[model samples]
Target: MADDRRLEVLSAIVTDYVRTREPVGSRALVERYRLGVSPATIRNDMAALEDEGYIHQPHTSAGRVPTEKGYRLFVDEVARIRPLSAPERAAISALLTGAVDLEQVVLRTVRVLAQLTGQLAVVEYPSLRLTSLRHLELVALAPARLLMVIITDTGRVEQRTITLMGDRPDPGDDGAHGVIDPVALERLKIRLNASLVGRRADDVAPALAGLAEQAPSDERALLAAVTGELIAALRPDAEERIAVAGTANLARATPDFTTMGPLLDAIEEQVVLLRLLSGDPADASGMRVSIGSENHEDALAEASVVTAGYGPGVGDAVAHLGIIGPTRMDYPATMAAVRAVARYLSRFLAGPQD
Candidate 1:
């Protein structure tokens, strides 16, 4: 019972600190919260918490503020994450369902997250490595060019143009010119789809290599060129894209100018943001909270990152979406916002449900 009461006092302190951005005093806690204890008792609890490194007095005679340990305990043990209201849920669905393409979806998502949480939002584009080929289309654009469209299960589309000239000259054409035969093109399309559809991006190149070697002697060169384009389209370098919004929100949340510049610069660096979001390889379809010094990045030591994975299901996170803000954030609300947005995004990317 003593431990539970101390936890309650700590929770109250965190709540008051976040709302007022001020150190919480024992008298304030006794007056504002129904702790059923005297101010002296509360002070004793505060002293014990400070000794345990959960709360600290910033000045010699000031009230107590929560330490990182205190915040972590509040997030893990004390805070209750309430479900978003009906109106909030409706707003999320309406905004996201209207996106016409992947780019728009990501753009709108970052905006919505920023607006909803009043914090910097970062979203990693769905990684092709985690998605399987949904479909592949081959359209002849000209006598020597073909437009190849690659669609993934995560609603990502990549298009590449392939030149088939010099691979095989048409029967009636000179050696310098060639035209793709419709019948051969259709056959190659079927073969390529049969070999690649439903395969992950990492497995695509190997599968295409086999298909190219097995093609008819006249079609082998054409198949090889098409496969080469497909491989390039799914290269790893193209999968590292992310969208960010609400940098200004950080300024509003953080009053300390000393750390704000470096924090803003770190946010501008995509590599640092990606590393921050992707740090937990073992985190699949769960909310991850990295608070204060726990973030490891020097610039982010004064910030907290709340992230959630979005995708088809557990163990299959296509990517991640998260918020970055000052460590003194409202953990419950921020966590709920991140979680709700991630769920809606996962459902949308999974397409129409049966």
Candidate 2:
């Protein structure tokens, strides 16, 4: 019973401090919250909480503020995540409307999340190796050049320009450019669609090689060029990239954080950003919070990260999205906003049926 009362006092202290941005005294707590206790009892609870490292007196003042431990406890045991209202959900879905492709969807998602959370938002693109091919378009440009468009089921599009290394074709498209044989292009398209349309990008060279071996001699060179470019697009990204928005919000909230410069720099570094944003449902909470020193990067020691993974289906994460802000943030509201935005983004990327 005593422990529960202490927890209630701790929760009240955290709430008041987060709201008023001031240290909470026992007198303030009794006045602001219905603790059902006298000032003496509240002060005793505060002393016990401070002794347990949950709350601390900043400068010999009687008023106390929650420590990181206190905030973690509040999140884990006390605070209830506020649900996104119907109007808020409608607004997020509306923001992502008319995005023609997955990349556009992700871009708009970051923007919406930034606006919603009022913090720096970052999103990782899904891995190309994990997505199956949806469509491949090979267009002959000029006599010796071909344009390759690779589309994935995840709505990512990759384009590459390849110059056919060995093929020599006459300029025949109305004197505009030498067009590869229409018959050859169509046959290659059929072969590629059959071999690639529903397959993951892994071990793709062998499949394309088999096609090249069986190609008619006249189309062999063009097929090889097309195959090579497609393979390049399929290779895993050497450096993972992320889209970021609302950096201006960081500067605006700088006063709340002591490590603002390093935090900003960390946000800009691809490797650092990836390390911070990457989370799995197996290892992280549904809506995870990495607060203060919980962030592995030293530069972000005074910052907090809120992240959730979104994918093509339930619980299978294809990508991660989240916000970064000071540890003194309103945790429940931010978590709700991140989760809500992620749900809409997953629907957008999951295609019409999702």
Best by lDDT: 1
lDDT of 2 by residue, 261-343 (tens): 77777777888887788742323446788877888778888788889888787886677889998877888889889888878
Candidate 1 lDDT tens digits, 1-354: 239999999999999998999999998998899999888999999999999999999998999999999998998889877798888888788889778878899889999899889999999988777789988998988988999998888888878889875644535432234567777778888888898889998899889878866777556656777878887777887647899999889889767335688888988988888878877553333888898788888988889999988897655678999999988988999999999998888888877878
Model 1: how far is 22 from its true place, Å? 1.1
Q: Judged by lDDT against the true structure, how good is candidate 2?
A: 0.80
Positional deviation of residue 47's Cα in model 2 after best superposition, in angstroms: 1.9
TM-score of each: 0.90, 0.88
How much lDDT does each candidate structure score? Answer: 0.84, 0.80
Q: Which stretches of candidate 2 lie over 4 Å from their true place?
A: 166-182, 203-206, 279-285
Poorest stretch of ten by lDDT in candidate 2: 169-178
Per-candidate count of clashing residue pairs (backbone under 3 Å): 0, 0
